[model samples]
Target: MGILTDTTHLHITTWVVAVILFLVAAFMQRDSKGRKIVHMVLRLFYVLIIITGLALFIEWSSSDPMTYGIKFLLGLLTIGMMEMVLIRSKKQKPVTMFWALFVLFLLATMFIGFMLPVGLDFF
Candidate 1:
């Protein structure tokens, strides 16, 4: 397959890993060691997601400055909210709001991808 197709596949796989990590980090109530391990794994997954996402973005439509700019801003906001959720207070409400924002951004990204003729030209 082409590089774009391969990259798309990898991107989807990385997202799946990210989702698993999110669930583990959000729901798992284990010992300190286990929690640490989960946190480490989630951090690594986040890095991979960012890297692959950038690669995919470059491959898809680097020619469109506006789309790229929007994507970059949204990505930064998503990551920032996730970091806040992880490191801010132990309070549940703020954490829930962060996760909710993360999910909303994720869904927004998917919707944009589906509706726009940009990434992968899949539609």
Candidate 2:
């Protein structure tokens, strides 16, 4: 539990794993073997991501409320985009827009996340 003792590590590890799972699920063929299982695991990571992310925000938001709030909102939107992509994909509809939005949110979130701990005031 040494590394887990650091909230940053916990948050980052789960975040990376969640994204990896997402990429895997996204590329897998429709109704392919293990698709549901991969998605279920990905969902669990989403929960962990929310929990750990909230904890980080609770601690860090005091320092920069604006950035934290934006990050939190972006996180929510990222998840929403992920769900939208999945739903649209399942319905055999176009998810190109949703996927683009998801990537943008993910990049923004990570950029701000790395900057936050260092007290960077780019915003």
Candidate 3:
């Protein structure tokens, strides 16, 4: 496979992992230690995904600012929502809104990835 194809595969995998983490983190029972562990592992996976994504971006030297900008914004929103969820999870506060928006952001990321023209590079 070509380098671009390989990078695309990795990017898709990262997003898939992120989606799984979001679902697990959002819906798992709060009192379960196993759930907590799972959430932690998912968080770690997300961090890895983000780091790998950055490395890929740098390696590719993407030049399409619009796609990159959208992705960065979505990433920030996702992280912010996750932090909110974590903070409220301990307090048993309703976090449905956060989760809902997080999911939407994930979808938006996927949409941007799919809709953007190939070879439209970003820094």
Once fitted onto the true fold, the runs of candidate 1 whose alpha carbons sit more than 4 angstroms away are 1-6, 89-93, 116-123
Lowest-sum lDDT 10-residue window in model 3: 114-123
Tens digits of per-residue lDDT for model 1 on 1-123? 255335466766766776777666666554456756877887787787677767666666556756765765676566667666665433444577887898888777665655444445655
TM-score of 2: 0.87
Error of 3 at 90 (Å): 3.4
Q: Is candidate 1 or candidate 3 better by lDDT?
A: 3
Cα lDDT tens digits, model 2, 94-117, are 999999999999989878777786
The TM-scores of all predictions, comma-separated, are 0.73, 0.87, 0.75
lDDT by residue for model 3 (1-123), tens: 245344566666765776677667667777788767877877776686677666655554366766766776786677678767865886799888987887788677666666555423452
Error of 2 at 116 (Å): 0.6
TM-score ranking, best first: 2, 3, 1
The lDDT leader among the candidates is: 2
Instruction: Write down the RMSD of all candidates, one decimal each.
Output: 3.3, 3.0, 4.4
* Alpha-carbon lDDT of model 3: 0.67
For model 2, the run of ten residues with the poorest summed lDDT: 1-10
